[model samples]
Target: MKDINEPSTAPLVIADEPVNSEVIKTTTATAKNSSNKKSAGVSSQMQLLALAKNFVLDGGLVSSDKQMPLEERTQKRARIAALRKQENLEAIIKKSVNYCSATEFTNKADADWFSTFTELAEDVSNTTMQNLWAKILAGEISQPGSFSTKTLKVFRAMSITEAKLLAKACSLAVTEQTKRNIRIISGAYQTPGLLNFFSKNREQNITFSQFSLSYADLLILADNHLVFIQETESNPMNKSESFHFNFNGKPLTLTANKSSCVLKFYKFTPIGSELARLISDNIDDTYLQHLKSALSENFSIIEG
Candidate 1:
């Protein structure tokens, strides 16, 4: 009876120990789970921040998609892309324009006069047409008869056959007197009318010698007399433009005068001959000015 009242000591002891062990295990597991959950939350927040930074760098926004409706987000992305593309295109255009200006043709054969004619033909504005005719009259067109009568008529409402006849007639009209004038200055070939016009009853024996330069040949017509023809790149820098006249078998020193906006020629020493005097004494400044004015009246500046 005493043993029965004592209760089952072994079973109680085993039960109590098992219950305590289970509680301890449960508490440890719960603490580990909580720590893992916190770590995961922090990692997720860091990932979101990184994503947001990347979007901003790429000209976009974080949560932009979620905040805006699907249609609005799509439209916004398209607009941004379009704007970027437009800016790129504009930059390309500006670069191309600058290049064209710097590298345009310098030869008379490849002159801008012909291009003007083509542009006029495409769009026959009265002002443009008149300008084209003026340039032609100023002897700007190097190959007068290169285009067919049909082309000319289509270009200028004139009869093709009639225009061809007129061009031939003009070429034949070149006189011997003009040829003599051009021969005196450069011994180089010249059109008959041009020769006659330059030589017209002048006793002053003008002579020209050609010298090679970086951009174009320099025509030295006696000492103070020089014509510098340079091939300039169409760019604003005008890097292709340079001077070329010989001084003691070397090029003359060139210096730019910022105040006058003109280049000053200096230190020219031709080996054997004295430098030729400049033709300013006999030149008709007024007539030359008028000619330039007339030429400009016909030509219009076209954006490259």
Candidate 2:
């Protein structure tokens, strides 16, 4: 795979409007003086002028005049909106190409899927969001069924904050080695059996807040149907039985030291599983250690 840090040589066809000077001025006001402020203002003006040249129609930037008829002004505004959307689409396409592999894909993206993607992506002007859309496009091209239409709709509705929350959850996510099912290992349940007859049933759960992922964040994910609202438990494992799991890309083998050991977790919905593929694996050493300590009570952890 090519390094993502390597810059692309491709040029953007049209640049968006320069960011407002007021935002920059407000941030740097205390650190800079009057001369610096004047230079910042002049720099912003030059950028705006450069942007105007990119959108020049006939001879000048698409600007409205009160002298023109109402219908003409309305048409001009619509044309400008269309041009802006076009620029957004081009920028996303360019970014997507960077993610595409040199190897050709055997399958092509569906017509309906591509159509829906373009309709939704054209209006996404935020650079961060645009990069996500581009990655979605590239993923679909590489493997047509990697993401479903429903997944796309859910993603389109997600705000940057919600997306970040999901990413945070993914950083601590785990999965069975042989299965693609994703889950958050919140706790474990030790069933009332020969090993724990006196204690009845024992349960151990780690609060997500300790790991910087709060319950409120989980509620948001559940509301979005990315994760099940209720906690799920695995089938009881007999003593000496072993299970393999992948945690943040690392493989682990866990063998039950006691009978009726049930692993408790929050399962990801189908939509969640699909979108989770987009998140790069980010290992949390502290979280992993905590999980190991908890599981050590009933199982032996073997890293692979």
Candidate 3:
């Protein structure tokens, strides 16, 4: 895998209108009285102008009005963009902090924090947010060091199949592992077309009836390692034909006539971890207690 920290050779492009200095001056004065404490830093005329200039890049006017100087307009636009970016970064940080502090299963605080994060991630249009969330979830599921490097790589794979493939293809390029894992996991379906169907339609909506049936088959294959086979018995019933060994150290039970599978594993106590960290961090216990109560009231574990 390429080192994430490597600087890209791609060009940086900024195509936006210039900032309006007069507007910044006026906005800063009004921001002084605003309840948003963060914006107060731009209240000073000099600070506001500096911020505007720093934010705005090219010498472009905020408005097409020929009366306004291009520099001032550029400054204004830059300031607005900078402020928006600052707000987004702050929100992400706050969400991450809150997520790290969560202490129980189904905590509303954590859920709320993650929801905010997901929104921000969508806005940012990047994989970083998803990666972070996956890491956090994995941490919650297993003890530190319990998850192998391969498992972590699988966690970061593009999809469930990709993750499994990556686990199996440790000898090859990291990118290929995910694809290989998917093939391995889906290899045993007696219906030879199942893999091809998933490959082609993973991103689309199919007929509801077909989707329902396929979903059941996929679930059985994924959870119970079963392969569905054709038969003739007046009314041949679909039965799970197991072909793989259970590796997760759990009793695997097939239910709903091979439509569902469940496994029992040690649950991670996220709430407990959060609580301990919060107490140690000396943050206000009241917020922590409130979040704990809310989560307890809302979430229930659906074992599978």
- Tens digits of per-residue lDDT, candidate 2, 93-174, equal 9999999998785586799999988888887876777888888989998889888888889998997778888888898888
Best by lDDT: 2
Candidate 2 overall Cα lDDT vs. reference?
0.75
Residue range with the least summed lDDT across 10 consecutive positions in model 2: 1-10
Which residue ranges in model 2 land beyond 4 Å of their true spot?
Answer: 1-70, 194-201
Residue-by-residue lDDT tens digits, candidate 1, 1-304: 0011111223212233333434433443444444324333333323333433323232233234335565666677677556654554344333334323344443354345455444434333233233333333222233343333333333355323323322222211111221211111111111234335465332211121111121111322212122222211111112223222322122222222111112212112221011121001223334323322322221211211
Instruction: Show the colliding residue pairs in model 2.
Output: none
Candidate 1 displacement at residue 91 in angstroms: 0.6
Instruction: For each candidate in the order shown, give its overall lDDT on alpha carbons.
Output: 0.29, 0.75, 0.32
C-alpha lDDT (0 to 100) for residue 76 of candidate 1: 71
Which prediction has more favorable TM-score, 1 or 2? 2
Local lDDT at 161 for model 1: 32
TM-score of each candidate? Answer: 0.17, 0.75, 0.26
| Model 3 clashing-pair count | 21
Query: What's the true lDDT of residue 216 in model 3?
Result: 43
Tens digits of per-residue lDDT for model 3, 62-88: 344533576766667767766765565
